[model samples]
Target chain A: MCGIAGLFLKNRALEPELGAMTAAMLSVLTSRGPDSAGFAVYGQAMPGFLKISLRGAENFDFGAMAAALDVDVSVHDDHAVIAVPLEREARVRALLVQRFPEVAVVASGARMELFKGVGQPDEVSKRFGLVGMTGSHAIGHTRMATESAVTIAGAHPFSTGADQCLVHNGSLSNHNDIRRKLIKEGMRFETQNDTEVAAGFLSWQLREGAKLDEALGAALDTLDGFYTFVVGTETGFGVLRDPVACKPAVMAETDDYVAFGSEYRAMADLPGIADAHLFEPEPARVYFWERAA
Target chain B: MRVAAAPVAVNEPVVFDLAAAGLRALNAALAGLTATTNQTVWRVKNPRGEHAIAVGVTAPVCIFVDGPVGYYCAGMNDGADITIMGNAGPGVAENMMSGFVRVTGDASQAAGASAHGGLLVIEGNASARCGISMKGVDIVVKGFVGHMSAFMAQSGNLVVLGDAGEALGDSLYEARIFVRGRVASLGADCEERPMTDEAAAILAGLLRRADARAEVGDFKVYGSARKLYNFHVDHAGHY
Candidate 1:
């Protein structure tokens, strides 16, 4: 099980202050996924994107890949930031596919970003500026490798396409079955993480014109075993608790904000939280929180 | 309304008279003290392993039991903090509302049973039936808990940093049970669920709050299978 957190601020600007809030919230949950920590910050100007961690190949050239795609790429100690042209994202994606196919595209967006690595929360925060950036909505993961190898790529908030990412906490018994189906549909995989298969499954449904909630519901139906996943997109976020509701998930929402975590303490540090009521998502229920159009 | 009274200052040596006091009296004396002012620290020099030493106090008082305590030492407690320096008997801090209850030594059955709120931090092992029927409470056990923990739990959080016994969370409701170590067996109507974003967030938050080092990915999720929610002939095996 890994710790996942996301905050969607309605009528609130995700600036430095909000970034600090996210950092504080994630800091309290450091023990959940001490292996790695990653987050995505959404903003107005940036095309939302997911940022993922990459290790083992220290000599990998991110600048060349960015230049090839005509986008700016910044490399940190354990992560890299890619800025994509929203209108020409498909073209850039083709370039990414052509080059550096080994490097997994974790998540993306003008505002959507994802970063993950192997270490404690403090280490990941220092490497990724997890506590420094700000956005109206953000999602994070702290992973403890279960079924997959404990590599940086296996960390969560995995993305299949631009502005589409997912973080999960339980295993899918039918991962291979789902993966086989997804692979047939042209979904490529970078790691052997079962969560990646789930990401592809959700994306495939969404690509078929299903709403985010409907797609997640279908994924839940198709997937077997204990799982609770949260999918984030450019416009909104969706949360699903499996039929058994085995994993722990608490949601506290108001008119202006919706905060969800495995425990209430993660939200204890959020600003403007006077009194927070906690409720678990009903079994097999798909809950969606969208930024008003 | 019998009340047991004991008065002692911080770092003061005191002897409790449990022979003359019942559970309600012990709680009254504890509740009457001012915890925030730090005027409520009492040391039990000769604890006779009595039951319900300090249950249901809203103050931030700290009571240190020098020796072992009997059942329900801090049941349904609110704010008063109690730490048993030695081992404890059954049902310590059952249905705790708030504050911190720590047991330095091992606890018998039903520690923090049905706790509605508060943080119950047990440094040592807790025996069977921990957090059973809990509602909205958070329990962090550094060691193992016995069988049927969180049984029929409606709401709250149970974090077992160590291993868990058989049939955990049998017929559970909405409570979230996170075990860092092994689970001997899952209870009836309990099935593993896919970990969602909300669950990941909640688990991560709990680890941080409990200061536990267990990773979210290393744990497994377990809850009711929903087949017995209303009970049907097709799912009669669960009964």
Candidate 2:
């Protein structure tokens, strides 16, 4: 199992201290998932397009591809960091669909910066400015590969073509069936990781006009297995645990913000968290954290 | 050597005084001793499910818990030797990095969950999901274990001297499970594998270490079939 943590601050920009808070939260959970670490910070000044991070199997030349579509691309050790211009985001996405269809673009952002790498939390945090950014909310994952290969691309917060990203902690038993259905529906896949398939499935639901909560609820019904997931969008964050509630998820909410993680140790670092009540989320519960509008 | 079994004195300042004094006495006995040389004796007259009564001691202190204990009675223990005279609650030695935890009575769920390194011996039955997600902990239970025991177990040796419940070793990887009794069912991709000589030796060693009389040859080994490690269309039903 991996460790996933996020903070959602409503109606306010996350304090600069949030970077330290998030880093501290992720630090206590390094043992839960030690293979790789990554985080996504969503702020008001962020862009509206998806920021797809690609890693492993570095045969594709992202610069040429980006140049072809007038999209900006940065490469880092098997990772293809692409920032699609807001106006031509659709065109760039179409270009990606046409090229390098086998690469998993795990996680995206507008003002949300995402960075992941293979190693300890401190290593990943240092490699990708995960420690010094502020936003309304942020989600991070540390992976211990059980089913998938241990690589940066296989690391989570998987993103679709839209502004949606997800971090998962449990196995999706019916991932192949869901992957087949999605493939039949013209959805392409990049990684052999089941989590990518889950991300695609949720993105498909959202594109089909399902609300974030409804889409996740539908996933809870159709996807069979023990899973705890946290999804981040441009505007809000959401968390869901599987029906049997086999996986652990503890969440505490005050009037100002909500913090959740696979274990209480991760959230123990949050400020103003007095008398934080910790309990397992009931089976099949879908919680949404929006701007509270 | 005979410690009388009695209920923990609750709401009484005298018993509290005695318990505190007992701890101090044990600490004094354990002073300037190594984990191997000490073998200190603790006579817990009334151990009514108290959490963390004797924990985190590195010396080879021998604690004879005269009665049952609550959650994490000897959790995160390193080097000290604990022998519970009665049952123990969930996570008896959770995340124990080293040392030994021996429960003479039954153990609750997650008996040794996430113990990175240690030797845990449960002489009685273990509840559901025992040894879930352990990392390098070695557990030997002389009785049955409930369903999903050793789920997603990364690295460990879980030996069940009696029957095992459904889905034993579900999604299991690397961890080895040896059971002497019937298995109710196997979880997704978990199957009974032929016992190898190394596994037999390991089982024999664990049984001998726990002082269990059970024969090693009578035990069957179960592990992940490795079918669900990657997604496949043919094995969709197992999911």
Candidate 3:
């Protein structure tokens, strides 16, 4: 069983506390998943630039790549977030492919920075300084690795589209069939994880001009299996569960924030939780809350 | 002359703080009790969604859990009266042999799955598969129940005071379902049967026992059509 926790702040005043709140929510769910943990934070966006989260090989020279790419890079453990001009994204990716072949672009967007690693949730959260992070929203996952290997590449909070991230708590039965169809549609995958296929499916739909909600609606018809998926986009936070909905999911919402957890204990200590509206997300329905862009 | 207040039977409840103690200890304490144990009242504090709060109890006791609970709160229960003051996770009273379990708040999927006997009551709505494969157990939901409820149920009665989701009873076997509100859709071989005098009496009894506020005449009864019981070759598509 995997655990998924997410926080979306409607009140910008809570942005500075997003990481701490999300970390606490994810920590209580360690028993649900203890092998690996991952998270994606959507912080402030810089005008005319994009923040690309990248992971490199052991002892990789990030400073040299920064010098060659001529971008602002902040190193954090084995991962770094590089700020590049929006126009230069293609050229920078090409250069990284040519020179720094060992560096993988984990996620690229205006505001989102994704980080994940193989370890206990506390260790992984500390490694990425998740408690001190400041963001408008965040999605976290701790995986027990049922159908895949326990590696960083197989961790969750997979971001296949810019500023869009997804974490799943249940397995997909027909991911391979969908994966083959997506590969034929020109979607490249970095791992054989079924969740990657789901993320890629959503990304493909969004790229095909479907709105976020529409993409999720399309997923209900195409994907088969038990799943409670929490997703984050540029301006929205959403949840979708399969028709069967065996996977446990509880949600709490108040004027301050909207939170999702695999279980209620994961959300019991959140701010204003005592007065929040708590309920379970229904089956085969898409629930989305968006911030005014 | 004013009568003195009847001597208050203050048997201070045996409190078990889940936050301060381990789950094993709490279960062991409950397990230690027999039918005639004097410690008949228990109060579980800070449940905080912990699982298996009071499972496999043979003692005739009353347990009041103060907060929400995780999966299988009262699994395999026998002769214990368990109540949750807050919501319950999946399989709240799963496989209960005989006892009484009630949830004051909503319950997740498979609330009383495959229970052999006893009465399970939910004051709030229950998610999918409310009483799947129930055998001789009685479930009364004051609110709605989700899809596939009472699926393949062999015997017993399920009463829902609110609406029911899709596939109310798929592949049923002699289990009776009574719903007060609309049914989204019925499952294969499950059909609405005209309420008879016996069925009405049964519904009345369950509502009286559950203390539910609903008219007995405003309900519909559903049970297996028995077409798929033997699995004829013509019914292969259903298989």
Candidate 4:
């Protein structure tokens, strides 16, 4: 079983503590999934600049790579974030494809920074300095690798749309069929993992002008097999479970925040959790919360 | 003649603070007990949704967990009285042999699943597959039970005081179900049957034992149709 956790803070006062709280939630769920871990943090957005999270192979010279691109970069373990003007994103993508073929673009958004790795959840979070991150909201995942290989690409928080990511807990049976259909529709994929297909499906729907909830509602018909998906978007968080709902999920909401976990243990440490309103998500229903822009 | 002072009675209930003591220590202590154990009362504090609390115990003792618990709480229990003061994760009292398990709050999926002998009382709602494959356990839910409950159950009874979700008691055996509220739909080979006097008595006894307050007349009994017990060419469409 894989574990999924998320925190959406209504109180900006708690923004600085988002990473610490999310790290604690993920750490508590390590026993459910120990193969790999990943997370997406949505912090304050900088005007006129898009943050691009990039991953590379071991010992890649990110500083020199940034200098060559004439951009500023901050390097984490096996990953880096570069700030590029909005107009130059296409040019940077072309350059990375031609010159820095070893680098992989993990995600691109104004506020979201995504990181993932193949290791214990705690080790992966620490490698990315997860506790020090300040964000408005965050989503995390720990993987047990049932349907795919234990690689970073197979990890969760898959982002196919800008500033939009999803973490899944169960396997999809008809992903190959869906993947073929999406490829014919001009969507790209990175791994054989089924979760990536789900992300691509949502991205395609969003591109076609379906709102997040509408995309999720459409997913209930197209996707088959077990799934409990927790998605993070530019301004919202959404949850959905399959109609059969074999997978476990618990959610807690308080005045300060709303939290989701694969199990109650993941959310037991949240502030004022004892008084929080806790409930399991109903089957085949889409629940979404968004902040005003 | 000097009589040895009575062995100091460990009268105070033993408080196992999960905040300080690990789960292994708690289960080890419970497992070490014998039928003749004098330490009959155990209080677990600050459970913090820990998994496998008080599992595989054979002694006849009373365990009170102060907060929510993770999966498989009191599983395979034998001759123990376990009570969870808060919500329970999946598989509460799973495969219990003989005992009494009670949850004061809502229970996740598969509550009392496949328990052979016991009495499980849930004061709040029970999620999907509650009492699935139950053998001899008597489960009483004060609130609604989710879909596919009592699926393929072999024996025993499931009493729901509130509505039941889709497909109640699908493909069941001798297991009897009594629902005082609406059933969304019946599963394959499972159908509602008129409550006989004997069935009413059984339901009354269970409600009393579980400390539930309900009118036996309000319940609708359900059981297997027995048509699927043996496969035949005529039933191939159902298969």
Candidate 5:
């Protein structure tokens, strides 16, 4: 068992509180998954630049590495964010690969930055000041380590694509088979996490031009397990459950925001929750929400 | 106006806030009022997706929960009228002996499974396995019901106003299934039978008790074929 929570602000006025609200929601779900925690936040995009969030091993010099890469960087405790030209991101990643092999680049997109760690959710949130950061939307996870051992790499909100990440609440029974199939198709495995396989599947689908809803709808047929997934992308978010819906998932939508949680208590503290339209996501159905461009 | 559950009772309904008082305190208070039939009402605030909200109730009291609940809320209730203003998780009012459990919003799987007596009403959709293995209770759903509903049902009636999901009433027995909307598919040993006047009256009476206004004429009834009822050597394959 695990916990997945996500929030998308319908009104831009609430964007500044995205991290705080999502932190509160994730905090409530700590009881569901106490092994590890993580979150991804989508901030305002700067034209022509991509924000790369990375975590490195002990004693890795993030400042010098940012200087060497010729990008402006913001350093947190152990995580750092670097803003580089979108056209040069490939070059930047290749450079990191050659020089900073010990560093792991988790997520990179113009609008998003991801952070994760192996610890209690509340402490991790405080470590990164998750309650103070602001963004347009965000998703979080508290992992119980049912599918894989408890490690920082096995934590949830696995990012396998640019600006795309996913958090899962149930174990994937067929992941080993599917992971082998995906690995044969050129997707690299970062850890033994089944959620990474799902993230890879969606990333591959999205790379193949499938929309978020279409990719999620296809997942309903292809992925077999008692699972509930909340996915975050560059411009939108999507939610899906297994055909049987053995995992618990509830969603609340108000005029200002849309929130997803494993249980209602995780979302009870959100704004306008008392009047929100709350319902459990149906089995094999994709519930996708997006910002109107 | 979203919080109101009174029927001219003299007692100022006891209020318990789950966030403050906790589940044991709220449940003990409700259990404390089991001996009296003084038309008492209890208002619960901030339920926060807790399970077994009013489980194993044996007295005639009124309960109003203001928030959503987790699994088995109101399970095994008897002689109480419970109303949840928000959604309910799996097995809401499951194995109910007697009472009226009303959900103003949707319900998760197994809305009223194996209920012996009572009326379970859902104003919104009910997910998979709604009323599975029902014994004698009556279930009324105003919106859609998900797949495999009323599975292995032995007795009682399941009424749905909207569409039903795949394999509804699979392996059904004795329990009457009435769906006003489309039936996706029937389970093994289940078939659609014509609604007789007697079945119509039963449907009408259940609808009245549930406070639903849909015409019984709009419903299509389904039930067991009785093919699996008696053991026979030649029909062994059907079993």
Candidate 6:
């Protein structure tokens, strides 16, 4: 009983408003998952630069760390979204691992930064300025804690590989067995959320040379559970549901952008929404749109 | 002399934009319609997959919803002719007492579930457990019906122009099921009954009401074997 919402900015003019729009969509789904919230915002990827988002304890000296590392870090509540040169990314990450062991690197992608917290969706979005961030495409989740405990680590938009993330709406019934297989395959797990296992599965599939559509369709055979998966990749996002389609998922596409929600009301208020071509996704079908590289 | 006043005859539709008025107000207005005087036409816009649209309208009215609807849309409807132009979520028109509800697209689980009276027409497929525990509703599905349809149906007519899913009419009672296509599997105590001229006439009437045309000979009837109602010690294992 979680909610998945995403927005892709087909129109570059709306890039600045991606965070705000995605936040509003996630907030509308607060009733579905009131325990915790998270988002993966995509910003422009500068050549030879890496963006690493880290979560630290309250009152952590993010400014001091930025000065020491000679990198730019913008503090948002307990998070510091740092943008550094590609060469120094390894050095800075190693430094954080050795000195600031408490800081958890949520995710580091070329154009995406992930933020998550344990609280009501609206409050968490405001705390992290999630509504103010900008990007080309983004995905967010409001979790109701069916698969694991309600903790920041268990929140969604779980990324197993760089620039690859996923948010799930239904429980993966066979996660425990699959988790062991993934663990044997040398994937690191930070939490017990079933959605994380799904993320790892996709990462493994994509790493093995499966395209987005093939990865999602193969999921129907390997993953045994009721689920509606909304996946975010570097180029674009895709949506898929179990054959039963027990989970709710709707998609709307206008001239400017493509939007996804658990219900249509989540997208009812979007700009140019009235003229959008809206429909419920078919069961067991992979509905995906990607921008050509 | 108590002659009931005629229902408000507004030539143009009274549009209820759910985006502006909210679902609560929309349902409240539909329920508050005068029982004696039935409104003529009502249009609901921006339903946007909201639940329970136009539920419990006892008045004789015609409702036109422009978008997809969530669970239990038009549930417990009575006398209102409701037409949904898009797909319906689970339990659409469940437990309807009387009236006509037409879903132009597919319907989710338990369509017309436990309905006592009314004619339900589905232009597309109906998902699992359709017409489960139905009482007296006359349901017509133009496409396939998923597994466990007509389970424990007490009394009703289910007319399927397409295939019926596995375990069709399982544990069925007096209710009759007319299947035009193949039955993947049959439930316990449900067996094929011979199609007669009388049953054919009834099916033809139902098809006509659903705005469908099919020869009565195309269907085969399935009903209870009448053995499960009485416990036989030797048949206990099957039961």
Query: How high is each candidate's TM-score?
Result: 0.59, 0.56, 0.95, 0.96, 0.92, 0.86
The candidate scoring highest on lDDT is 4
- Per-candidate Cα RMSD to the true structure, in Å, reads 15.2, 13.5, 4.2, 3.2, 3.5, 4.2
What's candidate 5's DockQ score? 0.58
Q: How would the candidate models be sorted by TM-score, starting from the highest?
A: 4, 3, 5, 6, 1, 2
Off by over 4 Å in 6: A9-17, A254-256, A271-277, B1-13, B38-40, B124-128, B143-154, B160-195, B213-239
The 10-residue segment with the lowest total lDDT in model 5 chain A: A284-293
Tens digits of per-residue lDDT, candidate 6, A1-293, equal 88889998788899888988998888888988999999998787878888888899989998988887888888999998888898898899888898889888888888888889999999999999987788889999998987788899899889898888999999889988888998998888888888899999998889889998889988888999989999988887899988767787777898789999887767867898767876667677898889853
Candidate order, DockQ descending: 4, 3, 5, 6, 1, 2
Cα lDDT, model 4, residue A262: 97
In the order shown, the candidates' DockQ scores are 0.04, 0.04, 0.67, 0.75, 0.58, 0.37
Could you give candidate 2's per-residue lDDT for residues A136-183 as a string of tens digits? 788888888887888877876777745577888989888999999999
Which 10 consecutive residues of model 5 chain B have the lowest summed lDDT?
B1-10
Residue A216 in candidate 3, Cα distance off native in Å: 0.3
Off by over 4 Å in 5: A58-61, B1-10, B37-39, B227-239
| Model 4 bad stretches (over 4 Å) | B1-11, B237-239
lDDT of 3 at A287: 94
Candidate 3: tens digits of C-alpha lDDT, residues A50-116: 9999999767788889999999998878889999999999999999999999899999898999999
Q: Score residue A241 of candidate 2 by CA lDDT.
A: 80
Clashes by residue pair, model 5: none
Error of 2 at A21 (Å): 1.9
Q: Lowest-scoring 10 consecutive residues by lDDT in candidate 6 chain A? A: A274-283
lDDT of 3: 0.91
- Correct interface contacts retained, every candidate: 0.00, 0.00, 0.60, 0.70, 0.60, 0.35
Q: Weakest 10 consecutive residues, lDDT, candidate 1 chain B?
A: B1-10
Q: What is the lDDT of candidate 6?
A: 0.87
